[model samples]
Target: MADIAQTRAAPLRHSTAGALAGLSLAMLVSSLGTSIANVALPTLSAAFAASFPAVQWVVLAYLLAITALIVSVGRLGDVVGRRLLLIAGLTLFSAASFAAALAPSLAMLIAARAVQGLGAAVMMALTIALVGETVPKQRTGSAMGLLGTMSAIGTALGPSLGGVLIAALGWRSIFLINAALGAVALLAAWRFLPGDKGSGIDRAEAKGAARFDMLGTLLLAATLAAYALAMTMGRGHFGGLNMALLGGAIVGAALFVVAEAKVASPLVKLALLLRDPVLAPSLAMNALVSTVMMATLVVGPFFLSRALGLGDAATGAVMSIGPVVSAFCGIIAGRVVDRLGAAAMIMAGLVLMVAGCVALAVLPGVFGVVGYVAAIILLTPGYQLFQAANNTAVMADVDSSERGVVSGMLSLSRNLGLVTGTAVMGAVFAFAVGTKDVATAAPVAVAGGMVFTFAAATGLVALAVAIAVAGRRGRIA
Candidate 1:
């Protein structure tokens, strides 16, 4: 078997710049799609003459599909080839975008968006995997930082871009624009990315590709779908259905564990997740930090608009401060991680997040926009630093043949964090405000809720710090 040292010496097929550009473009487009659709919700509701709950399915469907399929798709990329999977994914995404733009009914549009989500999942799972393959070990941190920056930019621009496009060219224009951008990304990927023929996976593993664990894949998909449904709908009506779905998720998880242990080729490597010291802790930190980051993103806009008396434009501007800081800080973090190693950066990031959350919780009203901006400055850079360093650490010990599945695992952790954070934080905010409808709540109520929710979020970040510290102690012992 080829060892980590041997794999590290494997020559990349493309220049670092070329590979980074191709992969970063893919990352940007996928990340952009996640939030771009949000701005069009009102427009879509009007166009479909659908209720708000029904229209929300357009977004929910996409997120659910991506979350459910990302792991399976990443595993597939490992067996087949990441390059091939990425090309196929980009093509599918573009085609879906076009279909969505042309859809005459809400149902069709939702279906198209779901397909688009599948494509995005493929891209998301492979973005870091491909980067790991293409860049040398010494430069992996910087490359990850670049990818992180692109994601920040994409997310930061999504709402503003969507609003502009919707006003100027209508809601369909958003998808249409994505279709065009996707086409360009596809071409660049094809032209720049290395072919699958000599990609990083070991020859022996490729030979065993036919032994793919279909049952494990299905179980994982079912688990993720059930969990996502439970979380998304649990806060609303249908308590009975939510309970059933949660129960199904628990069953699916147990069955998946059994199936993985027996399968010749498991969809996810149970040992890596459960026993590998390095990977286990890194993944845990990833999920926890992601939760903190996501919670802030979910709650930030509400605080700005309600508590700060900002309009849409000002709220957007204030909200963008984090991503903008992240863009520059991500680059710096990459280099820092490469020099100082991932552990220090990860610890520093968690500390910053804890401090930032505390500041936001305590100082929001006292310092006003300055406090919000200050908190964001700390939080965004902390997130970027943690992500770049943690990703490097996770992939550092993974075998080349296992990069695909491991990458999938990493992406899955992030998706889980995002969903969990959004649900939990929103619930906390709703509870604090004493109403499910926060948007309609009084400004004073919203301000109070913001403080309480941010304080709760601070506790979550503190927990992440504890986990990181425990992981470090375990490693030292």
Candidate 2:
């Protein structure tokens, strides 16, 4: 494991609070980009006279674009300059948002969304990486926690906000809102962010002519696109096409590895990922925890509506609790991590997640919605703690030149986990219910599936705990 650096670049001379605000808004808008359009999909389908599957691409295009381009853009930031590139990203995002709002055709909207996602990928990657330059080392956890809070707020707010906008003004209002917010974020960034002292890359590294690996970047993007499509296509029903794409992902991954190994400056350093105890385990735990979190999103609603017999409004309200709790708890979690240290807080967070999962597995069946809410109360804070601590642990020690790429990797791992959870955890729940059509499954079966899915989530988090412990031990060794 690499030793955690006590410091990175010198702290910014500008107002730290303002810089944090800019970063927080950047995180918020990017996260909002992810969830805001989801609730508007049906509205879009009707408005565009498109099939549900075609409208679904409105969401998929954004996600696929981000997943494909995030790391490449991160690497681009390291080479070109994070601050300059981020400004460009913000401009692109704002323009793309307005474009989406005014798009005359469904095809154009999807294309605009794809471009918006490219901008989001840059924002999401550089925000965390830039933290080192914005804040003092001692407050890293707190800054991370604040960013997490903003992200949770965005995710929690998006669906409800989009619903309201669509009802009052129409679907296009959502994109218009994003355009407005993107403009504000861009202004904040331009006015408050620190100047790039060394342009992200070390002067020595730049002098060495560290070039971007375009082939490696393309191979990785293609591989990730294949995997994302495989996991997402067919609406959770893995078919022949999904299987073929999955195979393509595997082969592409192999080729990517080969290309990366031989590249003069790889997008990702294979040796660093393989040998860095902290980075490797951190990425794994992030994916695992994200998968568990997604289970709550994918499976919780089913359990609430079918098993508990909640109405649509009631289900949505109850389902919003986790993100709301996380939004509030994020700062507190960061404080705790700052006090307890990232490594220790990690174990503590995982323990709480395990407990939360176990409680969910049995409490809902025994105590109903109250039990579910209680379990979430326990789980959400744990997630905030883990997210803040895990991010801090990974970013605190990374080579300064590679911060952008590392941040991108962290985001990518979480996204991959969500994609996996949507497919794998959903399948697990459906299998447990013993039904192809979960919407009409018996209440008892839905409850049973809830138990099974949360139980699996427990095991996954427990494994993450083990990984955290091992990483700590490796650090000590």
Candidate 3:
């Protein structure tokens, strides 16, 4: 195996700082795009004279495109050059954003969003891989932390920024803003990013001209698309179509596994995933923790609005605290992880998350807003720490040559967690409250449902804690 540690060049012409800045900007743009369009759904429905289901596709289409294409694009980056792919993705993303802004019809806008998703997928798949290639081994944790910070900030700001832009300049302004940001990112990437001449594995792969695993790639994409569709459509009802999609996803996944094992150069190295002691556990922990965290995000707003009788503005204000805390904590987590190692940080983070869930479950009605704020503070930093540290741990063991696919797997875990969290938690809330939507349920029902939800989330966190504990004997890196 080619050792990534031995293969990395000293540093790029612009150094680690410049590369980080460019990558961070790219990550921010991609993260922002994920949730920014959500605020415009109602407005889009009115403008296009479309029904709710049609307008909802504006969000669903983007998400599905990203989920389906991310892994394949990541593998492509490893074959070509990461820097080259980043530049191309940034340019394509910026152009797509421009097209979206200028869209004359809803269909055009949706198409533009799909293209944007593809571009975003490329960028997302490469961010960690590029960082691994650029940053020194000793400081990888810090770089991952900074990247996580930017992602948190972008995700936190997306909805608020979208609302503000839509209010000031209309929904098109959101894409216009993304275009401007994407342009800046593109310029920075072009100026700061080094060529892949330094990456021996990329060069070797190019020379060998290995056949791309089209069969495995297609199976993986189909599996993810079917799974995402099942989860998205299965929210309200587990009807025949949802069941069919779910079955298709299972079949596709099983086929993908078999195809990957036989392919000369598989889209995903199933053997690596199973054999790597650190990487597999870290990925599993990330997925589980993300599931718990996203469940909170999905239900917290409802708890604030219905149970506590808070308005949109107040709820938004309260909700902003978590991301704000997370951003700052991410910055701090890097240095701490560098000193204490990822396992320590992960263990601490899991403890905090479990505590926060317990607080939310038990103290919300009793302590009121204070308890909610406390829970947010705990969960925010907890998640930030876990994300930055766990990423560092995952990358530590991966060969530089394999970073692309590994990074894609990490990203896939998070996306899967989000989809699963929303579907499962929503179902749990519905079952608890005897309603399809918790938002419309009575205050008492909402409160009871939230408690039940948080209690369930706490159990998930406890499982994560057990994983962290079992893996704690070894050093993270």
Candidate 4:
């Protein structure tokens, strides 16, 4: 009997391992799609004989597609079947990658990328939702952390990998590599991931759920796209077009809320979603924390190059440290969350973020590179802790039917925060430097800008900590 039991359990263990590997690859491919093309932009420009702005569309198209369609696709998975949708998405991504690699014109390449982004939106949303099904309850945090680590690795590896591939086989090789990876990810997902048992959603679990909320999805997608465009246009300068788009986004948001309220089956359950103490605060804090984190990405390069007088290579090296640290810390943070519980770890992470922000604000100016590295070491680990715990808290108890939509919302919040940071934080830095062109600014001015931007970031993280504390108190009450 003991031998039989051990033999019986062996396949389950292998299945679990294979499932996790599939999910990790899904995350890695989606994130790699985001960062890999960025490094090849210049090469693409020269190849196509296009201006910088035109080539910029290659990246923007993918981002816009994901931002606009992610939530809809997630809700669609809930209505249809996550397993089926994920398989289709992976196939689409792989095919699109191949198309992108063979494109002879810039427009075709951009179109292919948009299609790829649609596929990625599905992968990103469903990957989180499927995690609940794949792992035991006790190991959820560890799984979430592992996913986080893969995301970090994809992000960190993209530029270096893209550079090597572009140099050896040309810019088209980047997309080819993604195509190969996507094919493997698709196979793993198909073979290892649990199949949908007659449409994935249980009728009892999804009471009152009707057909997919097409109207609400459309309204929300348009609003998000407008907002994304408003944030990104004019190269960080808010122009008349940006203002108009921003106004449109605000109006569209109001329409979406009203539409969702009236719809029998809404894309999002606004009341229940907002009312959940853990979920609401986690989403809010995720946005705030992501905004703060993006500040480092946007401001660090300029500060290192201008203020610290580092060359391009040295600046790149210093900037790579944050992602490298995040990649390693993700699993550790997850295990800690599992041990200490999500609630406690969330607060602990916030506290560390506050300290890290403060350190970034002060230490870099005084101690230079050493101080910057120290601040990053503190900040990156804190982010990993918060991410793992927050994701665990949100998804741990989510209803089976609602998981996909909720996961999409989580990704949406983080993306919005990143977009906001790029525009708002960049402006703040420029204003602090007292110049539009930061490259020409004096070292002292650049350093002052760095200090000012990080000072604001510190306050932002402190605010997040306060929010976390209040949420915990309310939960206890």
Candidate 5:
């Protein structure tokens, strides 16, 4: 009788765990689609006879729409109901994927991709918010670990899977595959995932959110768009207007930040990050690391294929090693952090990333895929370690009421950093190469980008080290 009672009680303890797992699966599907499309871009470009600027929009459209919408959509879920948003997002994403798969022109494809981005924003919002709510405070680290592992796998598999599909069918197959997975996720979420009606929504969740900040959204969107365009257009050497737009982006972003700080129920809690104990270091470190990692991901594929003279299949295969290793190592990083504390893990991970970037930057141009693959494997472990630990640290410091906002801010930092990193690094590499043949120009481009990454990694590690040294004790997972 006692044993049976304990067994039954176990479910009560982990009721939210199952929901988290379902949410994790949803993240994997969406993230995989993002990267998988990258590997297929060259093939799509060839087939469409698309210009370089136009081909790039396939990615930019998704990034722009997703980044702009994440905070608004996520906070809305907290205000309304997470489950409602989840269902709506899945439906819209599925429809968009179908259209993307059948897109007859680049313009139509960009539109479809934007719709897909909107859906992705919802999924991103829900996944972390669900973990924060469902998992007990003590077990949140492990829950986040599990979520991070799945997302890492999706990131790694996307390129390789896309390569196979593109080779077997055509570029259309990549988008179609996403549609199929979205369908699967929709079914799974509907069946296995519990309703968020009485879950993930608390008294403090986005109270008084009816007054959405329209002007703030517009200014921020314009800034983000203009900035992204500046970076992308600068690749071929910028016109005067592009530079002017870049300057405007700087001004717009400043205005939005100031506006957000003063508004009642601001669109983003820019002030909270300043006032909160947990968020300052955690968010800063996460944002810095994210910028480096995202830039690496964007440029690494192009470098692997072009610099080392590898093909799509081989490049994807090599890229898979990092995420595959991350899946395994992430577990260990989580456990180590739980026992030894996050500061150590943060330092170690940052060190590894610096080393990895330096190696890739300095590696001989002729080392081929082996050296490239090895460097990425080193990079992934650091990324996963930081991701899990950072989330744990941030959530540990804040009250439960603040988790939704914190998660949204954390995710926004990551997405915006990634979008910026990729665009900037990619354009830098493109400029370095100067339209020379990939074989001749790629080495220089890769070196320049990796140098930037190495510098960024060093700067991030310096911040983590400083924080570690400055404090006596902090909330640890």
Candidate 6:
């Protein structure tokens, strides 16, 4: 890992409460924008007369682009400058959002959304990285905790708010709202963020002009792109084609790994990933958590709306209840992590996640006041624990020089995991539908979901217990 440095640090000053508040708001704006759009997909589909399959692409495209690019751009921020990218990202996001609002066709909306995703990538990559640069290290966890809370709130509020917005205005109003929020975030970044000469930026431009391995990046990009396209095309109609594409993507990913292994300053530095014990565990955690989180996403809507017979508003409210609690609980979890260490915090989280999933998996048709809902609330705290604790461990383990790559790898793991989790849940649902006890199909699907998530959580718990029992002082985390 190459260290990028600024010759001088900005003058030390504790940012005002107002500035911190502004930063949290920026996070909320971005979180709300994405969450709101996802929840409103049904309305958009009806408005555009889109096939269910095609409408999926609209949501998937944004997720794919954001997942693929966030890590790369985040590393670029460390190489160049966080502030420059922060402002540029907001500007591009706002412009794209405005354009999306006016898109007259589905094709246009998809393209515009991909661009919006690119901007979001930049923002996600830099947001926490920028906070590290701006705030003193001591208060960093608290700041990040609040950001997580906002994200949870946005996610919880998304469906209900999106439904209201679409009912009152139109589907386009979601993008319109994104435009306004982006503007505010832009202003906050410009006015409150500290200034410094972007590290490694001018250096890259000088002398012989060193190049980051664009080829390696492009190869990996194609791997993800092809895979996402295959996923979008999945089903009996294109099952054969999906298989072919999946095969090609697997080969591309293999080649990418080979190329990264050969290069000194590889696009991702796969060597670091292999050599560091800390990094290895972190990556595993990332992949597992993503798989669990997205599996719930796949199953939650069906359980709430179809099985529970809840309307969109009620579905949103009930489904989001866990997230609402998780949001505030993240702060407390972070503090617990500080006191007890990552190992303890992580173990507790994984255990809760399993317990939560078990409840839902075995849930009866009727809610016993807190039976179904309590499971969701239980699931929420664990999510907070996973995000707040593992992230801290990752940061603490890796050197600042390699932070960009670390962030990128984590981001990639998360996105790919979402796709994989969704696939697993889809498979489980399809299988359950074929059973004789078909009326209880949803619960069976829920049980299958718990099986996958618990497996993931179980793996993490095993690792956490090992660390706790052995007292392994790892280098990478």
- Report, for every candidate in turn, its global Cα lDDT versus the true structure: 0.84, 0.92, 0.85, 0.91, 0.70, 0.68
Scored by lDDT, the top model is 2
Summing lDDT over every window of 10 consecutive residues in candidate 3, give the lowest-scoring window.
6-15
Cα RMSD, model 1: 4.7
Q: Could you tell me which residue pairs clash in candidate 4?
A: none
Candidate 3: segments with Cα more than 4 A from true spot: 1-12, 198-209, 473-477
In order of appearance, the predictions have TM-scores of: 0.92, 0.96, 0.93, 0.96, 0.81, 0.85
2 or 5, greater by TM-score: 2
Ranking by lDDT: 2, 4, 3, 1, 5, 6
Clashes of each: 0, 0, 0, 0, 0, 2
Clashing pairs in 3: none
Report the error of model 3 at residue 69, Å.
Answer: 1.8
For residues 187-298, write the lDDT of model 6, one tens digit per residue: 7777777764545646445522246667787787788877866665664234788889889899998999998887656777676667666666766766666666765666
lDDT of 2 by residue, 1-477 (tens): 233342333433477898899999999999999899999998999999999999999999999999998989988887877877898999999999999999999999999999999999999999999999888988999999999999999999999999999999999999999999999999888888987767545642764536778998899999999999999999979999999999999999999999988877788899979899899999999999999999999999899999999999999999999999999999999988888899889988899999999999989999999999999999989989999999999999887778888999999999999999999999999999999899999999999999999999999999999899888899899
Model 6: lDDT equals: 0.68
- The better-scoring model by TM-score among 3 and 5 is 3
Error of 3 at 469 (Å): 2.7
Residue 344 Cα positional deviation in candidate 1, in Å, after optimal superposition = 1.0
Candidate 5 backbone collisions, by pair: none
Q: What lDDT score goes with residue 190 in model 2?
A: 81
